[model samples]
Target: MKVSTHQPSGLSAPGLPSPSLFSSLLFSPSLFRPYLWLAAALVASPLLFSSPALAHHFADLGQMKPTLSNGVLSGLAHPLLGPDHLLFLLALSLVALQCRWGWALGLLLVGLLGGAAGLAWPGLPGAEALVACTLVVEALVLLRRLPPVLLLPAIALHGYVLSVPVFGWSTMPVAAYGAGLLLSQGSLLLVALWLLRPIAKRLSPANLRWLALALAACGTTWAFSAWAG
Candidate 1:
């Protein structure tokens, strides 16, 4: 009896196996499109949780003084201290330059005015929720390739939300607190400028979403703590 060798029909003539379920879904560009978004979300989710890593410091900084001029200074520096805030502002500031230096200041002014409202207002219930919502939405903006316009509002909300009186409004001199916040935030901003300068163009596409997600996550937690107590 003569025996003939036969190749599996599931494979190509060259003997390569057909795209397995794992390989097809994993390697197929069309199938991966939606997953690319989900992956972006997942890889970036850690940033949402990033603030906790620095929470001890924020708490330490809380002990600093709060003043009107200092608050003004903090307001200026706030964008500097934290990576989340830095990423958010840096992403926007990059775009702001297109408008001119005066326009950049205008952007800062808009942020300032918005922050003032946040500071001056009575604490809104579920502010943490609003914060979370802000972050999530901010992330969504990047998911959709949103323009810098969205960033200004985000910066404003961040200031107001963070400014909500946590408990001690009387003991610390307001100026001292404000100054401290500025000092801390400003220092960080400078750091962000240095680090962000090099990788910005490369990271720009995903940085906004990453930062927004991070901000929203932190805001949600803060809001939760605020609402709970």
Candidate 2:
């Protein structure tokens, strides 16, 4: 009787080393995708449960003082302090990756400029409700359920609303505040978009889906909190 041996399809020979663990994880859809989603969900959980009062407090910083330094600090602190705004920018970073390079910068410019101009515009009624709605709309657009065209107007509207609190009813020059707004939001946008460019590459499409889902959850939480208030 004679015996024969067979080799596996991908292997060159019996003793060759297999692929590295990092490469295997990087390439394996079955292994890391679910874990990434779980991690994202866990990260978003705190934002969902945070106090609703914080949203009101941070969104309106003009009550402190109208000084230049204060304005700059307030501007820097608003987004970082408010989960609603921070998450909004995070979602925008991801969405902008799919848009033109100037898209994110344009939105920031429009927002800061609109806020500066919002001083003259008569206070828009139901502005709070509208701002809350923008989050939901943004999430929808990110998930590709809504047209991207709507994003510009929505962000402009948010800028206008944000100005009311930051500048209040004061007629003073907003040069400093405007500069601060630009600096704070611009820095965040640049960093977030920069970071997300690589992340979007590394993450599987399925992992990206979960990130969108997490954003939607955060938006829903903020909207509900705003509505309750």
Instruction: For candidate 2, list the clashing residue pairs, or say none.
Output: none
lDDT comparing candidate 1 with the true structure: 0.50
* Structural similarity to truth (TM-score) of each candidate: 0.47, 0.73
List where candidate 2 sits over 4 angstroms from the true fold.
1-43, 51-53, 56-63, 168-173
Candidate 1 local lDDT, 177-229, one digit each (tens): 44455455445444444444334444454565565566556556644644555
CA-lDDT, candidates in order: 0.50, 0.68
**Model 1 alpha-carbon miss at residue 26, Å:** 26
RMSD of each: 14.7, 9.5
